[model samples]
Each structure stands twice: as structure tokens, then as C-alpha cells.
Target: MHRLRCFALCATLLCPSPLLAATVFRCEDPGGHITFTLQGCSEAQDLQLHRAHNPTPGSGQPVPLAQTGKTTRTRSQAKPSAPLVVGEQGDGCGNRVTGSARRTAMIRQQVLAGMTRSDVESALGKPDKISTQNGRTRYHYRDREGSSRQISFDDAGCVKGKP
Candidate 1:
């Protein structure tokens, strides 16, 4: 057992660890959301591969990967087939709301004050007509019954006071 242990130790000290190279994938969805992962992305997303190799031996430092060139593989070079749907409340909106609250508000189609332009656009789709007068912007929408609903935004791009 002692001789075997010595032999194993000698072998380990003599052998240099093999260099390993890992392939990393950077995926971007149609909405331009980026994510990096070892696993590849779906067919709908744009795929980019980044390869990094292990550092050389005896240097006591890891070598940085060279930025040779970038490779981007996309499913389709043309525009996406479907439109992107932005969430109602997230993405650093001033109106901070929980998931449930945002979902309920979206379902109810409620556009509250303090909500940004993007927030309103997310909750209710694009307006039928937009008009700007005296630094205030108004978004007009016509319902199925031909009833028109209007939302006004102040110069700051936030809904005024209350709905």
C-alpha cells in the first residue's frame, strides 16, 4: 500500500493537468434580451459562441481569451414574424408593482397615473391615434363598440394625477 501510494503521488506530480476549453453561448431574443449560458439557445433566438481555453502551465496566471472575431448565428435574417410583447410593470418603471398586481391590472386593462408611456403601451396595446397639444400628449383608442377612450400624458411622459 505504501509503495502504491508513492507511485500514485509520483505520477500525479509528473503529469501536467490537461488544458480544458469550454464553449459558452450568448443568446439574444428578438426583444434584445441577452443571456449567457453553457447550454445553447432556442431556434428563435440569435446565437453567439465564446470559447475560452484554460491557461498554460507553470505561469501561475490564467491567460485571457483573445478577441479574434465574433460569430452570430440567427434563425432568420429578416424581421421577426411576431411582434414583441413588453411586460406591464417591469424593466425599471417608476410604478413599482408586484407580479400579481401587474397581472391583475393588465387583465383589467387599467392605466393608472405615475405609469410611464411604455407601461401604458404594455397594458393596453398601441393607441389608435396620438395627438400632442400644449406639451401634453393624448393617446386615443376606440373600443369594439366604437366608444373612444383617451389617455393623456404630461410633458414628463407620465400619466397625469389619477386615471
Candidate 2:
């Protein structure tokens, strides 16, 4: 019958097929940073592609892509800026020193990035540790050191005590 044939065709078209399903991929970098993207995983090195099922609407579930493949090229991105550094300009230490003494005595030491506490102490000397309760690192130094009568390094490792 014409009606039966039409019904059979509709059912065949509505059924799900593997060829029409989407694929999902998990990407990772050399540093172990992982990310999920919708693009195919052809060029992505160390990337894992997996076939996932599509989720229902408003089900709070993740829906997988329909294709799985590797990429041959990587997209370039911009790098972040370096950390900020604090300097000492004013204060009596600069004036007290003699003529050329000012330049030689008042030397500014910019702590290198990723330097540990021991490294800083070795470069500068034993700092007078100040008590802190609010999760902050504060070091105090008097006229014993170079210029800037008082010096303080904040939690971010910036000098703010005095210059």
C-alpha cells in the first residue's frame, strides 16, 4: 500500500546512524594543561579523540561533537606580560651619602622572578621578619642596608618599605 511504503521510508530516515554522529576530543599541552574544543583533533599532538553521545536539551549534560580527527597545524596566541617591579626613589638615604657615594651606596636590587626566600636572604642579608596575620609577607630593614632607610617587600615580592 502507498501509506505503508511512506511510513517505512519515514522510519528509516528518522533512525540514528553512526555515520551521522559527532565526535569529541580532549587536548593537552606539554605542560599538562587540558582543554576541550569543537574543532577536529587532526593536528593536535597528544590529543585524545572519543565518540560521545548527544545530550537532551536543558539536561545539564555535555554534548559531544559529531566528528573525530587530528589537526596538522596549531593556532598561535599572544603571551602575557611580565610581572611588575617596585622601585625606591625618595628618602634620606640617597641624600646622606657623599657625592659619588650616593650612586654607589644607593643600589637598587630587583629580585629576580621565582626567587625563593633563602635566595633573597642570601643576596640581601638576614631581613628583620615582621609578624603578619592576614596572609601577607612583610620584611623590614633599617639604615643598616643601602639607601632607603626602611624597606619592605609585599606578598607579591615588591619593595615598598622605604627608599
Candidate 3:
């Protein structure tokens, strides 16, 4: 009788009003990348063990993964492109002619006030070199003809002086 009473008490303590457990899904891509999703677990090939819990109904909150902080590593197997080449003659507008005339033209057309360092570098390849002094950063770009242009930026990274 004592054992029966203890079992009944334990059953009552363990069983609660009906509450459904959350669904979990694991997925693998063609590239061998594995992703776990809670909303789409039926597609998982290897079903893991299940536990009983009262997950809030329709909360739509994502279950945080234990390995969420893992970073992916990638390898590149292609060679880098050669430096851009320019032509010898000058355009009628006084701009030196170059095979990269379109790119140079676009860079010259951009208004410097709102430009960022990355934008300048994208328009013009990495500067021949960079120098900083007195809160100013200077980017120098040298052409094949030995002519060089210096673009200066203020602390805020906006062009501050004439290029």
C-alpha cells in the first residue's frame, strides 16, 4: 500500500495538463553543410532522442543552437588579376587616356564630400601608399607615367583637401 501510494504521487508530480513538445529538425545540404531547424524536422534522416517539455504554443521563438559561435573557413584557388593598364594618349577633355578610362572617369565624377575610404579604394585600386599626420590621412595613387595624385581625408574619413 505504501509503494502504491508513492507511485501514484510520483505519477501525479511527473504528469501535467496536456502540453506539446517543440519539433526539431536537422538538415544537410549538397555542399555537406549541416543546419538544424526547429520548424522543419520531419526531413531529418537521423532522428535523435526526444524529451517531454512544455514549450509555449505558437511563440515562434527560435531555439538557440549550442554551436552558434562556430566560424566557417573557406579556401580560394584562383590567381589575382593584373594591375590595370592605361593608354598613352590623353582624352579631348584633358584626362589622360587609359584602358581603365571608364573606371578613372567614374572615380573623377564622384563628389568627394560623401565618399568613404573604401569607396575611394574601390574606385581607384589600393593607393600606392597611405600616410597620416595631424589628423589627416593622405592616399597617394601613382600612374605608369610617374604622375601621382594625393587625396587627403579628415578624421571623419571624408575628403578634406584638393586631390
What local distance difference test score does each model get?
Answer: 0.81, 0.54, 0.64
Model 2, runs deviating above 4 Å: 1-110, 145-163
Model 1 ranges off by over 4 Å: 1-100
TM-scores, all models, native as reference:
0.40, 0.23, 0.33
Q: Write one digit per residue (lDDT tens) for candidate 3, span 47-130.
A: 443444565757777655475577665567444588556764543323323345545545674424445576577678788999
By lDDT, who's the top model here?
Answer: 1
Top candidate, metric TM-score: 1
In model 1, the Cα lDDT at residue 147 comes to 97
lDDT of 2 by residue, 46-155 (tens): 78877766556676765655777885654564443785558754333232324443333334443333333444565566666554546556555544455442334456
Winner by lDDT between candidate 3 and candidate 1: 1
Root-mean-square deviation of every model: 21.4, 21.3, 19.6
